[model samples]
Target: MEKDNFDEIIRRSIAIRKKYHELEMTHHGSEWTVEEDALAYLTDAGLVGRDIMSQQLRWPKVGSEAELEHKLGENIWWLIVLAERSGIDIKDAVHNFLDKTETVLK
Candidate 1:
């Protein structure tokens, strides 16, 4: 994908997350706490691992390929949301991580 398209997808993901946050606040009298968000993210992340395992036949198949794909996307969405909520720029964090890892590996 083009850089612009990738950037647009990130932007859209962030916006969708913000919308869900608002909905939660409206319905529950407040949005989820950071810890709750972290736990939710972790739950989905664990599911992704399990999905992969199932696909590999290391575990019984409980989920479909489409579910695995959704879980992966959801994990990325959670990462972006967490970074935004923590006042960090996801793009900068990713770039810094890659640069530092590349330097260390070299």
Candidate 2:
């Protein structure tokens, strides 16, 4: 993806998380704890796996490609939120991981 597009994704992801945080604050008395966020992410991640399995017919077909696409995006959103909550610069972290992994593989 283009740099600009990646930046937009980060921006929008944070904005969406902030909206949820606001709701959590209103209903739960505080925003989600990091552990809670991780659990939620894991739940969605599991759904992604299930969706992929269904698409591949490894399991009973339970969801469509559109559901898989949505879960994938939600996982990305969760990653962004997690990184942000941990005070890590996600873009730089991704770049560094890719660089190191590529060098090792090469």
Candidate 3:
């Protein structure tokens, strides 16, 4: 994707996170801690894993691909939120990971 498209996605993700945070604070009386967010991410990851297994096993009615995509997106959203809470820029973190992976692979 183009840089502009990636940036737009990031902007939208940030907006979504802001809205979620507002609702969470309003209803739950506080922002989620890193640990709480991590648990949510893990839960979604487990769902994704289950979906994958079901697909592999040729289950009669596996979870929809859209469901898996939604869970993965939620995982990414929580990861971004956690990084932001820790004072890290999500874009920079992604780039750093890519750079490190490239170096390690070479």
Best candidate (score: TM-score): 2
Residue 15 Cα positional deviation in candidate 3, in Å, after optimal superposition: 1.5
Better model by TM-score: candidate 1 vs candidate 3: 1
Q: Estimate, for each residue in 10-33, the C-alpha lDDT of model 3 and write its tens digit.
A: 677778878887999999999777
Task: List residue ranges in candidate 1 displaced over 4 A.
Answer: 1-4
Ranking by TM-score: 2, 1, 3
In TM-score terms, candidate 2 sits at: 0.91
List clashing residue pairs in candidate 2: none
lDDT for model 2? 0.93
Q: Please give me the total number of clashing residue pairs in predicted model 1.
A: 0
Candidate 3 at residue 2, lDDT? 50
RMSD of 3: 2.8
Provide the TM-score for each candidate, comma-separated.
0.87, 0.91, 0.78
lDDT of each: 0.88, 0.93, 0.78
Candidate 2's residue-wise lDDT over 3-99, tens digit each?
5588888999999999999999999999999999999999999999999998998878755688999999899999999999999999999999999
- Position 31, candidate 1: lDDT: 84
Quote the lDDT for 104 in model 1: 100
Give the Å shift of residue 9 in candidate 2: 0.9
